[model samples]
Target: MINLFHFVLILTLIVVVISVAKIKDLLSAVILFAVYNLIMSLLWQQMRAPDVAITEAALGAGVTTVLLVAAISKTGRLEK
Candidate 1:
């Protein structure tokens, strides 16, 4: 059962990662990247690496997402 959850999480991450890459909307892509980072943090935790998970969550999901949003707001939503 636990392993099933892990599989599903990984599958969802893969789909989200693909969506992030294929998206033309900058804002949407940033959001998806943030979600991907969050999922990665969870995966790291599950793998027994709490330190890495915390770092991933803080930098990838938190600070990076904030920075991306600020940059996007300064520019535009759609990609050229």
Candidate 2:
């Protein structure tokens, strides 16, 4: 069961990565990248690395998303 969960997590990460790469909109791509981080964090927790998982969830999923959005906002192209 655990192995299956990890497999799914990795698969999700791959799919998100592909989507992020192919997406035309920078903002949407950034959000998809954040989702990728969240999936990896779940995988970390499954591996019993709670500390690392928490960090990834907070920094990768949360902080990175904020930073990306802020950067995009500064560009003014994000409005479209």
Candidate 3:
């Protein structure tokens, strides 16, 4: 059961990564990347690494998402 959950999470992460890479819209990619980070944090939590999970959630998912959105708003939302 745990293995299945882990597999699904990893598979979802891979799919999100591929989508982010393929996406031409910068905003969409950023959003997907944020979600990927969230999943990673969740995985860390499940693995009993609370410290890593907290860091990943705060930095990777939270701050990074905010910064990316701010940058995108200042520049452009879509890629040329």
TM-score of every prediction relative to native: 0.94, 0.85, 0.90
Candidate 3 regions exceeding 4 Å error are none
How big is the positional error of residue 60 in model 2, measured in Å on the Cα after superposition?
Answer: 0.8
Which ten-residue region of model 1 has the weakest summed lDDT? 1-10
- The positional error of residue 26 in candidate 3, measured at the CA in angstroms, is 0.8
What would the per-residue lDDT of candidate 3 be over residues 2-76, giving only the tens digit for each residue?
A: 698999999999999999999999999999999999999999999999999999999999999999999999998
Please list the C-alpha lDDT of all candidates, in the order they appear: 0.96, 0.88, 0.95
Question: What is the C-alpha local distance difference test score of candidate 3?
Answer: 0.95
Between candidates 1 and 3, name the one with more favorable TM-score. Answer: 1
Deviating ranges (above 4 Å) for candidate 2: 76-80
Rank by lDDT (best first)? 1, 3, 2
Native-vs-model 1 lDDT? 0.96
**C-alpha RMSD by candidate, in order:** 1.6, 2.6, 1.5
**Sliding window of 10 residues with minimal summed lDDT for model 2:** 71-80
Clash pairs, model 2 backbone:
none
Candidate 1 per-residue lDDT, tens place, 1-80, comes to 46898999999999999999999999999999999999999999999999999999999999999999999999999999
Off by more than 4 A, model 1 = none
